[model samples]
Target: MPPAYPRSPRRNGVHYANAAMTVLLGLGSNLGDRCDNMEKAIEALAGLPGTSLLRWSTVYESNALLAPDSPPMWDKPFLNAAVELSTSLKPLDLLAATQAIEKRLGRVEGERWAPRTIDVDLLAYDDETITTPELVVPHVGVRERAFVLAPLAEIVPSRRLPGTSETVLQLKRRIDDSLPAWMGVVNVTPDSFSDGGRWLKDDKPTTAQLELLDGNYIDIGGESTRPGAVDVDSETEWRRVAPVLEYLDQHFSGRLLRPKISIDTRSPTTAARAIEAGVSIVNDVSGFANRAMIEILAGSRCDLVLMHNLSVPADPSNVLPHDCDPLAVLRSWFGEHLEILERAGIARERVIIDPGIGFGKSAIQSLEIIDRARELMEFDCRVLFGHSRKSYLESMTKVPPSERDPETVAVSANLARRGVEILRVHALDLHRRFWRVYQRTA
Candidate 1:
C-alpha cells in the first residue's frame, strides 16, 4: 500500500528561501464527481507550501484498474493529468503533501489501483532517485502507462527520467527522427542585435566554438538585419563572413560528423561566394525577392531558407495592415515565391520556410506568428523559426537584447510544441540543456 501522511498546517507570512527544484506529479480520479475531485486536488497541490504549480497537461480519460469481483462503483473510468511544479520541499515532504491531498479529497485506504476520489503520485523530482519502503520515484509505472506518459509528454516531451535514458517523447515513440533540429547562430557582423561585434576583432568564431554550440547547422551571418540598420555591399558582406567559412572548410571539409554550414546573406554575390566556399544552405533574410538571388540559388544544390520580410533592415513601421492576417500574408508571399522557386528549377524540398519573426511585423503580429506557427506546416517544407533575442520580447517586459535569452527559451519550448522544425537561436547551450538535459543536471 502507498504511504498515507497528512500535511501539517503552513506557517503564515513565511517565504521559502531554499533553492527550488522542479517536480513532476501525476494525478487521477475515478470516484464521485471525478472532475471536481481532480480540480480540488490540483488546487490543493498548488496551494502547498513552497510549491509553485508550473503547468499541467490536458486531462485524459482512461479505464480504471480493478480487481476481480470489485464493486461496480470501483470500476469506473479515471480522469488523468500530469503537473509540473517548482518546489523547495524535500522529496519525502513533497510525497507526504501529495498523499495528504489524496486523503483530504476523500480517498480511503484500500487495494492498490482501486477507485478513489483522487490519486497523486510523485512522478519525478529534479533527477533525484529515491527508493525506500514507503515511496519509489519516478513512480514505478510511469513509463509503461499511457495515462501518465500521454499527459506528461504534452508538457515535458524531451524530459528524461532519473534512472532512464530515453526522453518522455522518445518513450512515447510517436515522433520521427527528423524533428527538433537546432540551428546555432554565429553573427560575424558588428551591428547584429543579440551578440553584435562579439565575434569581431580577437573573438572570431572557430571550429571548436561551432562544435561546442552543437547545432545541426551552423548559421553564420555577415550582416545585421535588425530594425533600422544599414546595408553593406555584397563584397563587404563576403569579406566579413569569408574567414569563418574558410576556417570551417579547412578543418571540417572531410569530417563525417561536422555540422552543415549556412551563410546568411541577401546579396547574390555573397551567396555565390558562400556556395563556392562549400556552404550547404543559404539563409536569405530578404526572402529571395531579388531575381538575381533566385537565379543563383536555382543553379546550386544548396538548401535555401526562404524567409519572409518586408524590408532588409526591417522597417519597424512596415507591418501588415491592421486588419490583415499575418498567416494569410505569409501564405500569399510563400505561395508566390514557391512557384517562382519551382520555375527557377529549385525543388521545393530544398527550401526551408521561415516567417522571419520581428522582421516587419508589429509586436502583436510577431506573437500571432508564434501562436499559430503550426499552420506553416501546410507549406510542405521544413519550418525554421529565428526568434532568438529579438525586440518583440521587450513588448511585454523591459529586458535588453542581451538579457532576453530566458524569454527566448520560453518561446523556443512553445515553438517545439507547435511543431516548428528548426530553431535558429543565439543561446544554443541553454536550448540544448532545456531540451535534452534531465532536470538541468548539465
Candidate 2:
C-alpha cells in the first residue's frame, strides 16, 4: 500500500485525523522568462517536505489587460497557468512554503501589483472550511478570476468550492460576466505605492488624472504605509488627507461623476474626519478591530474595507509553520471585528473584505492570500483587491518600485476577471486602459 498520508498536525495542540489534502495553486508571469519562472516556482514547491506537485494545466498566453490607447510600452504578454498539489502541510504551512519559493526566485519587495517572473497562490486546501486570524480557505477571489478559474477548471473540472457547491467548471463558465460597477482605489496618502500624492495636490481636482479612472471607487489615504514609511500623528495625517476629501465633496458631490470615496485609514480620528467630509467608504488597513475606528464608522453610513494584517513579526528568514496561516488569523480577526462592528451598529452591507496584500506579510504569504482570495469571500462580503504596485510585485520582478505598472495592470486584470468588485490601482490611466480591455472582452 502507498505510504499512509500524514494527518493534519494539530490545532490548540490537539491532533486531527490524518488526511491527504489536495491544494490547487495558480502561477503566472510576464517579466523575464515567464515559463522559467513557473518552472522555478514548481521546483521550489517540490522541495517542501510533505508536498508534491501532482498536475498542471496548459499555459495560456493572454493579452495584457491594459487599454489599447495606452502607451505600447505598458502592454506586455502574460503566461497564465494553474497546478494541483498533494500536501500534508496544513493550509498556513503550505502558504509559508510558497512564500519561501517566491523569495528564492528573486522576488524583491516594493510597489503593489508590479510584474515578476513567478507568482504562486493557494487556490484551495482540500474541502475543509477554515477561518483563522491569518487565513480563510477557498481563496475569496477564485470565483471571479479567469486566470485562476480558467486554469483551475482545466485541472479540476469536478472540484467544487467547499461552501457554495459551485464547481470550478461552473465558475469558469461565467468568465465573461460583468459586474454592476467597477471598484476604484482611493489613495489617502501623499506617498502610496502606485500614485503617491497624485490626488491631493494643491487641493484641486486633477481633471487630467481623474479622467483616466475606470471605476467609481476613490480610495483615499492620508498616511504612507509603504515599507520604511514614517508613521505620522493624526494631525499631520488630517492635514494631508483633508484637502482631498474636501475637494471631492466640493467638486463631485451629488454629481454623476462622483465615485464612491473610501477613506484608507487605520486611525479612528481619520475615519471620523473623512466620513464627516462626505466620504462614504472606510478602508481600514488595520482589520476593523480598532475599537475606536469601528465605533466611529458604526454610527455612520460608511462602507468598510476590513483587511487582514499580521501584527506579529514576519521575519523573512524564518520558515513559516502550518500554524501561521495569515488567512486563518484574518478570519478569526474578522469574526471578532464583525461582531464588534455589528454591536457598534455598523450594517453588514457596508462592509468589504480585503486580504491586506503585503501588510506585514512575507512575499509568499501575499501570493498565498491572492491565490486564496476566493476563500475569504466565505464571510459573504464584497471582495476588494489592492495589489496595485505592492512589494510582492517588486519582489517577483526584482525591479524598482517605480517601474512596475505593466505587472500591476496584469494582476489587476486577473483579479478583476476573478470577480473582485474593486481594483485599487494607483494609475488612473492604467485603470482606464485595463477597464476598457475588460469591457471589450467581457
Highest TM-score scorer: 1
lDDT of 2 by residue, 189-285 (tens): 5666656666656643343455533345667666777655677788878877776666655664323223556677788887787776666677877
Deviation (Å) of 212 in candidate 1? 4.8
Per-residue CA lDDT of model 1 for 55-142, tens digit only, reads 5654555567667777876667777777887888898888888888888999999887577888888999999888999889888977
Q: 13 in model 1: Cα distance from truth in Å?
A: 71
> Which whole-number lDDT from 0 to 100 does residue 78 have in model 1?
75
lDDT of each: 0.76, 0.65
TM-score of each: 0.59, 0.55
True lDDT of residue 252, candidate 1: 52
Superposed by TM-score, candidate 2 places the C-alpha of residue 368 at a distance from the truth, in angstroms, of 2.0
